[model samples]
Target: MDTDAYTTMRFERRGQILTVFFRDPAEANTSDLAIHEEVGRLFHDLREEREARAIVLTGSGPAFFTGLKDPVGSLLWQREQGLPVIDAGRQVARRIVWDLLDVEIPLVAALNGDATGLGATIALFCDAIFMADTATVADPHVRIGVVAGDGGAAIWPMVMGPALAKRYLLTGDPVTASEAAHLGLVTHVCPVGEVLPAATAFARRLAAGAPLAVRYTKMAVNRLLKDTMAGAIEQGLAHELLTFTSEDMVEALTAARDGRTPAFHGR
Candidate 1:
C-alpha cells in the first residue's frame, strides 16, 4: 500500500498483515491537529489496499499515544482563527472512529505504553487489544474539562460495562495494564518488548484465516457498536464542544499549563 501521504503515521506491509505506527516517537506520539486529521483519513487508504488482510495499530517510543500535543497552542490558534477548534476536533473524531469501526478486516492494537484520551478510544475499537505490562489506558477528557465524546461514550460502556466506564470517564483515572486485563478491557498483556511481537503474531493469524469469513464476521459484530456510535455521537460531540468554551475548561487548561490544580466553580 502506498502510505507516503500519511504524515503522522508509519505504514508497513508484511504480506497480508499491515502495521501502522503513530509518528513522533520522541514526543510519545502526542497528536496535534495534523495527526488528528490523518486519523480521520487513513482508513480510506487502507480500504483501497486489496493486499492487506489484517492490521496492527500501535505507537512508538515510551507511550502508545498521549492525548493532545500543546493544548495551549491549539487554544491560541483557535482564538486567533475565531473558530471553535474543540468542536472541529470532535467532528474529526466522529469521522475517524466511525471509519475504524466500519473496517471489515480484523484489527489489533499493540499498546506499547500509555494510551490516553483519543488514543484509548482508538485502542478500544480494535478487534483485539494487546498491551505492554507496564502500559496504562485512560480517557482523560473530563480532566481537561471535556466530555468523552470521541468514542468513549459510544464504545466504553459496551466493552467495560456502564459502571466501570462511568467511573473512569468521570474521574479520568488511568487503568494499569494488569487492571485492564483483569477487567477484560484487553485481549492480552505482555512485557513492553513483547507487545509488538504478540500483536503481530495475532494479526498474522487473522490474516491467514478465511478472509471473507473474517471480514463478514467483523462486519456483523460491529453493528452494535455502529448503532451506539450513531446514537450518541452527535449529542455527545455537541456537549463536549460546549464544555470547550466554559469557564471551567479555560481554568483547567490554564492550570494544566501551569502545572497546578484548577478550581472549577461550575461557571
Candidate 2:
C-alpha cells in the first residue's frame, strides 16, 4: 500500500500474509490517530483479499507499542479538528481493537519488544503470538486511569486463570515474554530479534494446512471462548467509555504528562 499517506503505520505484504505495522519509533510505536486508521484499513484489505491467509502484525521501528495515544495530544487534536474527545478515542479503539479482532484469518503478533495497554491488547487479538525473549507485555490500563477497551478484557482470563488475571489486570503490571509464553498468553519466546521470523514460520505452517480444516478448527475454538467471555468485552469497553469524560481521566493524563502521581477524587 501507499505508506506516504500515513504517519503512524505501514501496510506491507509478504507472500500470502498481510503485515500491519505500527510506527512511531521515537515513542515506542505508540498508538495514535494515523496508526488506528491504518490498522482498520489493513484489516479491511485482508478481508477483501481472497488469497490472503494470515496477518502478521508488528511494530515498524521498535518496542512493539507503548500504549494508547497520548490523551493530551489527542485532546488537542479533538479541538484542532473540531471533534469530540470521547468520540475520537472511541473511534480509535473501535478500529485498533474491536475491528482488528473481527479478522477471521489467522492473526499473529510479532512482538518486536514490549507492549503495553492498547499495544498489548492489539497483540491479544491475534490467534497466535511470538515475542522476543527479552521483551515484556503488560495491560497497565488501570494505572493509566481507564479500563481496557480492547480484547484483553475478554481473553486475559482465558489465557491465565481468573485469579492471576485479576492480579495483572487490576494492577497494570508488566509481565515478561518468557513468563507470558509459560502462562499460555504467547505461543513462543524467540531470540531477541527473531519474533517476526518465528511468527512467519508458524503462520506459514498454518497456511500449509488444509484451509477448511484450519479455519473450522479456529472457528470452533474461538466460539468456545466467545461463550465463556460472555459480556467481558462489552462491559470493559463500557467502563472505558464512561471513564473518558471523567475528571479522573483528566487527572491521569496530567500525571502522565507532568511526571507525577495522580490522586483521583473519583470524579
Candidate 3:
C-alpha cells in the first residue's frame, strides 16, 4: 500500500491497472478533508497515465468505504473558517465519481467488505462492482442523522428500483449480498476470498479489449447515468448543504455523539 500525507487513501499501479484503496481502519474507512483531496488527485493522476487501462478501488481494513460522518460539522467547519461551505466533501466526492464515470479507462469496485454512505457511493460510481459474499452495502445517511445525499440520492434509484431505493435510502438500512445481486446492484458477487481476484480478472479482460471501443462504449453508458442523475444529485446536494446550519442537524449530531436516537423537530 502506497501512503501519502495528502491522501489518506492508497494507490498501487500494476501493469495497466491502478488500484486505489480507502485505508482508514477506525470509523470504518471514513474520509476526512485530506482524504477527499487525495482521491481527487489520485483520479487526476490516473487520468494522465497512458498505460492505465483500468482502475479498481476497495478498502484496506473492513470496508470499501464507510461514507462521510460529520455532514453538518464538516460543512460548518468551512464556514467557521470563513470559506464557502457548499458541500465541500460532497462536491469533491461527486467530482471523484464523475471522474470514474467520465474517464476513458474502465472502473471497477472490489467490495471486499461493508460499504456505507460515501463508501457506497464510490462503489456505485464504478462501471462495474464486484462484491464479496460477506460484504454489505448501505447508505445509512438518514438513520445516522442526515440527509441521504452524497451519491446515494443520485445513483441508488438508477441501479435498484424506486421502491427498494426508497426503503434503503430512507431507512438507512443495508442490502445483503444476495439481495444486492438479485436487484442488480452489483455486477458480480463472489465468495469472500474471490472478490479481489474476480475483479482483477474481470478488469484484465477489459484491459485487453479494444481500448478505444471499450472506452467509447463505457462513455456512452455513463452519459446515460449522467443525464438521469445530474439533476437529482444537484438538488439533494443543495439540501444537504443547507442542513449544515439547520437545527435538526445540530440535534442529530448531538444525539449521535451522546449515543442516543435523535428526535428531529424538522427545523
Ranking by lDDT: 1, 3, 2
lDDT of each: 0.82, 0.73, 0.77
**Per-residue accuracy of model 1 over 1-267 as CA lDDT, tens digit each:** 568977678888889888999865346344467777888887666666688888998996578877456866675465445445656776787887877877888889999999988889889889999999999999888887878888788778888889988999899999999999998889999999999999999999999899999999999888977876677777778887777677787788889889899998986
* Comparing 1 and 2 on lDDT, the stronger one: 1
Q: lDDT score, residue 101, model 2?
A: 46
RMSD of each: 2.0, 3.1, 3.0
- Candidate 3 lDDT over 143-245, as tens digits, reads 6456776668888989887888998998888998999999999999999889988898888888999999999998899899989998888787777666655
Best by lDDT: 1
Candidate 3: which stretches are off by over 4 Å?
A: 1-6, 25-31, 67-83
Itemize residue pairs with steric clashes in candidate 3.
67-118
Instruction: Give a tens-digit lDDT track for model 2, residues 1-267.
Output: 354556566677778777777775466354565555565566555554566577787887658876445656764444445436666666666555544545567888999888877778778767898899888899877775777766677778878888988889988888997689888888888997788888888888887778778777877776776667648876776777776666776777778789999998987
Cand. 3 Cα-lDDT: 0.77
Judging by TM-score, tell me the better candidate of 1 and 2: 1
Off by over 4 Å in 1: 25-31
Spell out the clash pairs found in candidate 1. Answer: none
